[model samples]
Target: MQDHIVVLTGAGISAESGLSTFRDNGGLWEQHSVYDVATPEAFARNQELVLRFYNDRRRQLASAQPNRAHQLLAELEQRYRVTVVTQNVDDLHERGGASNVIHLHGELTKARSSKYPELVYDIGYRDINPGDTCDRGAQLRPHIVWFGEEVPMLDKAAEVVRTADHLLIVGTSLQVYPAAGLVYEVDRDVPITVIDPGEPASVSRARFIRKGAVEGVAEWVAHYL
Candidate 1:
């Protein structure tokens, strides 16, 4: 049986591909908080604003290419059963040759009906305008797991982690809750490895690679070759 390798990725992984984090916008707009743009309350306040925000993000994602870390993980599928659980909403993993990927925060390339979340459609890199509606006649919202929204795939991710023979954590600070808890869910005997430039907040079991995601994952995977 092929060893199951589960990789947990965060914004750091996508950052290497030039994906911008919401850390600072330099007051270019109205100085809206990240929560102001990512929460249900925000969407309720301005539907067009929310839709436009996601539309731009989807477009930006379309222009990004998956980095070395992403492609290497895909190659690992040949040697072991690989499952990628990423906090990123971009589709770069699939484009980078990874066969199986779980988007913990949902996907930017999809939209769903406001009345029925199950009625999701792959919108690709298209903009999701306020006028877009589902079959139910409700406005289409980004399929993202927004702030204060439940992460629908949390349980599924934990289940995948529980089965891992080897675990790799990349580009995450382990500050995000629930997803961060996945580290504790792995079997005690399972070996864990973490690759990040900064010191991770809390990952006691894994061996550390103090480098950027692409360089770190590449270095670590090389040892196995």
Candidate 2:
């Protein structure tokens, strides 16, 4: 068995395949505010609007493909104990062949009961419309962990980071909390490699690859691995 390897991914990785970011240079989504669509209050106020936003996301995910970075990460699984802790809701990491993945934000291909967190269902190609109810007569909601929702996987992700021998950070601003704090959980001695176009704020000293996800990651991995 190889030493532990932990990877953290975010929207930038998926953006390589043409997916949109939540905020891009003061984009519409930023102005619209995630609070209006990504909060429990928003959903409670207008379920239809919330459902449509996710439906649009789901459809976009259907058309997007994994990029070179995703492929390279998956290839690492062959020789290393790779654990992907992603903030992204997409399945590209898995689609590109990564074996062990923990999605902190929840998955788009799944839905959970509004009344019960454990009652989750996989709805690969189906649309989640209003009034869709679970067996217990509870409404079904998107599996996403909204802004105010507790990130259940955060503790598990921290444990993964603590055991890692090496850390790979890809395509995130390191601004989002909890998920971003995971970098601090890594053993101080462990080496870190951050691949991104911009300078990232890392917990420890990190070797920066100043390029976008696809181009930078493929070239860097080829040189290092």
Candidate 3:
């Protein structure tokens, strides 16, 4: 079997593609507070506001193209079994030509029934309005893991990390919970490389490349054994 390379990505990867991150400042998401747009309570309180916010984000994501870092990581599939565990909601990785992606937070191209989390559908770049409904007539919401919700894919992500022969973490500061905890699941001997601006919390044994995603990842992967 080909050696596995588990890649953990965060907003910092997409930042190179011109996408903005929500955590750069305290809880403010696109000028709105996290409580105003990223939580179930917010969605429950103002569905229209939440829908509009995501609609704007979906539109921006539609215009955003995959950057060099995204493309390079996808290209790694030629020599190794590459699996991407992304905290980002965008589809840049898939658009960059990578197969085998696991969205740890959720995906922006999908909509799930408010009543049944299992009922999810591909929404592409379309806007979900107030009248949108699922098969059971339940309202449709973004298929995202919000602030107060549980991460359904965390276990699978942990499993993937545990099986990896190599690990690459890009763009994330390793501050996000549950996802951050995943690094601890890696076998101590597995080598890790972190590429980001801020200081990422230390993993088992990491090689830090403090630069933007494209430059840093390109530099490292160039001579990767």
Candidate 4:
């Protein structure tokens, strides 16, 4: 049986494929304040603004393609039991052919009912307007784990990490909590590799590949695997 290989990804990986992080280049996401579009208070004050912001993000996601790092990870699944736990809201991993993926930051291609969060719908290239409603007749909102919301998948992700024979982390700064803390969940004896251009925050023993996502992941995989 192949050893379970759990990989955790963040903005850096997707940024290689043209996806920008909310904190990139001086702490701003898409030239707008993160508070204006990503907070529940912002949504309450101006739903239209919030909806349009995500709509724009959705359009950008539609335009971007999976990069080398994404493709390589997909190929790794051929050799290992791969499970991708990503903080990206985009569907790049799925598009890149990663079969098992968990989105910690929710997804861009989905919308849920305001009344019932479970009533989510797959929205492909469609705009979520103000009047969009579910069976309960409540407005629809982006299926995203916005600021201040609890990540429902944290426990499951922790369990996955705890059992991994190898842990591969790519493109994240290890600054964000909950998701960032997950690295500690892996068995200390299990080997861990982190690939990134900038030096990511670390807890002793992680082998760091200091390079961009594509180059770093490829190099690390070649040297170690």
Ranking by TM-score: 3, 4, 2, 1
Best by lDDT: 3
User: Candidate 3: minimum summed lDDT over ten consecutive residues — where?
Assistant: 22-31
Higher-scoring candidate on TM-score, 1 or 4: 4
- Error of model 3, residue 51, in angstroms: 0.4
Error of 2 at 9 (Å): 0.5
Q: What is the lDDT of residue 164 in candidate 3?
A: 90
TM-score of each: 0.95, 0.95, 0.97, 0.96
Give residue 215's lDDT in candidate 3 (0 to 100). Answer: 94
Which RMSD values do the candidates have, in order?
2.1, 1.4, 1.4, 1.3
The CA-based lDDT of model 4 is what?
0.89
- lDDT against the true structure, per candidate, is 0.88, 0.87, 0.92, 0.89
Q: For residues 1-225, what per-residue lDDT tens digits would candidate 1 score against the true structure?
A: 999999999988888998876532442134556656788898889888888888888878988999999999999988999999999899989999999999999999899998899999999999988778999899899999988999999999999999999999998888888789999999999999999888687677679999998999899889855
Give lDDT tens digits, candidate 3, residues 1-225. Answer: 899999999999998898888878632365898898889999999999999989988999999999999999999999989999999999999999999999999999999999988999999999999989999999999999999899999999999999999888999989999899988888988988899978788765698999989998899789684
Kindly report which residue stretches of model 1 are placed more than 4 angstroms away from their true locations once superposed: 23-31
